[model samples]
Target: MILEKKVPELWTHLLMVAFAAVCVYVFLPSLLIIYKIIVTVILIVILSIDLVLIIRKKVNYLKLTRLALVNLSILLIIVCLIFYTTNFLVLTDANSLKSVLGGSTLMGKLLFLLICFLQPIVLPLPEAVTIPAGSAVLGSFNAAYLGYSGTISGIATMFLLARIGG
Candidate 1:
């Protein structure tokens, strides 16, 4: 019984690790296109399983909600990639992106947060463009904190709207 209860929790952590690993490859991109394509296919399959579980009511409501959110995030990522691959959004230089955040740490943090928060819904820009630039400006820790917080808030807002309207 305890093992059964712990399985989902373990799977959640593993999924997060898989997501992080795929995102990290965008930074150290050596033959990354091939690798990302492979991992993305795997992620898609994992997401499909989650969707089946959610639709079948195999998980509790909380887990269902989480699955929904993660699925939405992955869809957003695919949208961003589509824009990127089709050249709808220009790939500006990282220095330019950092300069846009300005010099001071506080201002840099706020601007990074704002950009990351708005990127998904408003701009359709990917973190590949923002996170590296933000890290160069605010250092790794601050950049990661602001980026994650802003992203979570944006995603939560999206999920709330879906919940309200669904």
Candidate 2:
């Protein structure tokens, strides 16, 4: 009986991960309409299955509900930030993005560091964006140092969160 319950919950968890990957990898980066339609279809199917499972009470609905809420909230926040930031800053290119990072200002360095740190764990900003920008503004060695530092710390924070939550 316990195993029966656990298997469905495990399937649900796997489905959620797949849904998130499609959203992050397929839908978020691309602007093509075809990709958007595909992502929408994939997401709809995944959500439908999860909803059916919850409706049938085959898995723990409460946990799945909380997970969905949190995931949606984070994705919404990231999307809003992307649109708002792009409009406000008018970042037309990678060079423009680097300029916004302030080149060598202390606040800019801190902000860059913060972005790098938050990016791996929370923000969906690609490492390609962060690392190359940092290298351009802060020099190759310094950028590499900061990038590694932030990445390591971010991974450590993920481990800490999982340990505490689990």
Q: Which one is best on lDDT?
A: 2
TM-score of each: 0.42, 0.45
lDDT of each: 0.67, 0.68
Model 1 compared with the native: what TM-score?
0.42
- Superposed Cα deviation of residue 73, candidate 1 (Å): 39
Worst 10 residues of 2 by lDDT: 88-97
Best of the candidates, TM-score: 2
lDDT of 2 by residue, 1-166 (tens): 6446666665666666565655556546645678556646656665676667656765555475547645754774587569567664544355766887765567767867777788778776778877888788887887888888888898889889999988
Model 2 Cα shift for residue 38 (angstroms): 41
Task: Give the per-residue Cα lDDT of candidate 2 at 134.
Answer: 78
Per-residue CA lDDT of model 1 for 1-166, tens digit only, reads 5346646764774566466455536533543478567666665665676556555657554365456447645654675576456543333557677777766768778878987777665666678878889888888998899989988888887788789988
Error of 2 at 128 (Å): 1.1
